[model samples]
Target: MHDFPDIDYTQRFIFDESDVRGELVALERSYAEVLAKHPYPEPVAQLLGEMLAAAALLVGTLKFDGLLVLQARSLGPVSLLMVECSSEREIRGIARYDESLITPDATLQELMPDGDLTMTIDPRQGKRYQGIVGLDGVDLSACLSSYFVMSEQLPTRFWIKADGKRARGLLLQQLPAARLTDPEEREASWQHVNTLVDTLTAEELLSLNNETVLHRLFHEDAVRMFDIQPLVFRCSCSRERSANALVSLGLEDAQQLVIEHNGTVEIDCQFCNQRYLFDATDVAQLFAGGGVDTPSDTRH
Candidate 1:
């Protein structure tokens, strides 16, 4: 396959000696594509980036053929931040915030006062699962760490960073030990790995590639990493889906909208800024289970 520079890939690693695992995710194109759809402020953009990166990392550890959604909502200026990553690594995200109240330097708690972070896994065949935690920590990393510790009782640490252009994240978790026995041994191993990870700087993470970053941090250990998994920006919204949404509004409303808009009903995809157009006839065919198309779907 093609090799992309400093963007759209995840690397998972495990130390041979310790019962610990780690993941590194760098999102460049996907993050930029999401931002291109909406002009989010610096602070809101950062929050969205963190959620995007975190969603990718969380998906790495699970085995499900569905979508994983990470959402944060509160009664503050930044009301909602949501990111969705599918099993195929197709990702999309959006944020709703009061841009007028955003300051130059806004913290997560400030942006989402009384907020709750919710992670939902919607499987293709099985039942969906959701876990939620309050926004008690100072930042996204801390809050997520707390969630894992309290909810799953796993020792997990995260270091995430984002600017206007890139979002990068590192995750280290203590797994069930195979070699190390006793609580003290496991604790020591966790500390050893964490100490190495602690030295990583935000600049290096956002700039360097996966191999360089892993080596720079864990060169002394017996760390083994699998091949890179690529990520891309993709929206699940479609004309059929939009048509069904319109159909949900009942046949009368759908026809009314078409009449009000000059015999056309237009819907926009928030993730990708794609528009789907449906006229009166298309709506009739749509409810009849016939196929539909968007402006972009047609051949030039």
Candidate 2:
């Protein structure tokens, strides 16, 4: 990084006179906190950082009160990489990889040369929407940008970078126009802003502050900057939520699982590695009372 202090935050900005809006996210504490839960290899860790950054950037663009999940699965060395960002700005992520297949310096395409990039937006008040795209790009940023271009038909670009220490990204999109809008002028603005942001280097993206990066790229324009939003590494899983999930498995199925497991049902969160356990009493109360009435938490 640079000589500046480390930061874990996301900032949104838009050109005051144009239809181009963008967001910049720099994650240090949150990224390292998630990695602290698991000892992922270098390549895997970097990929997870990218996903976490992507999740943070995407979460702010929607108007939902739920969760956004970014999952990449492949038959290659790295089988899974997942990140969850709640509408509240809490983030968590993890990766599953084969140590033998991963090199000390492996690129994303090498580790996950072929996979599906899955983006899920679940609203608390409406039906969940999921979009899937083939991982045809050489990097994670390119793949996500491709997803929006084909799936959402939005002119978008992503500049994501991560070392072992930090994860950061910048996103730019052409906003939807209103009636009587000029298509040619809108397209010109998109191209102009993208061309300028394309000049950002990874060092500047990850090291400098959000304002500095913005001014460096868009100093000539009247860019309106919004208040910075803080992002923390938080896990939203709880015994009650897990129990509700078990209840969905049905009374008979849940009890059967408890019996096979020798007396209690256990659900482990892969993101935080915390285990939420429920005993016979808990299970009975969960079904009989319609919830996880037993609040016993065996965090592992």
For 1-300, candidate 2 gives per-residue lDDT tens digits of 465344577889988888778988888899989989999888898889999999999987887999999999999899999999999899999898899999988887789877888999988889999999887798999999999889866677889998867999999978888521788887777889989988888888878887788888988998998888888999988777788898899888888898999987779888887888887777888889856554656432
Model 2 vs. true fold: TM: 0.90
lDDT agreement with native, every candidate: 0.87, 0.86
- Candidate that would win on TM-score: 1
Going through the candidates in the order shown, the clash numbers are 0, 0
Alpha-carbon shift of residue 14 in model 2 (angstroms): 1.2
- The Cα error of candidate 2 at residue 112, in Å, is 1.2
Output the lDDT of residue 78, model 2: 93
lDDT of 1 by residue, 147-255 (tens): 9988875688888889888899999988886879888989988998888878988888778777888888887889898888999999898766787799899888888
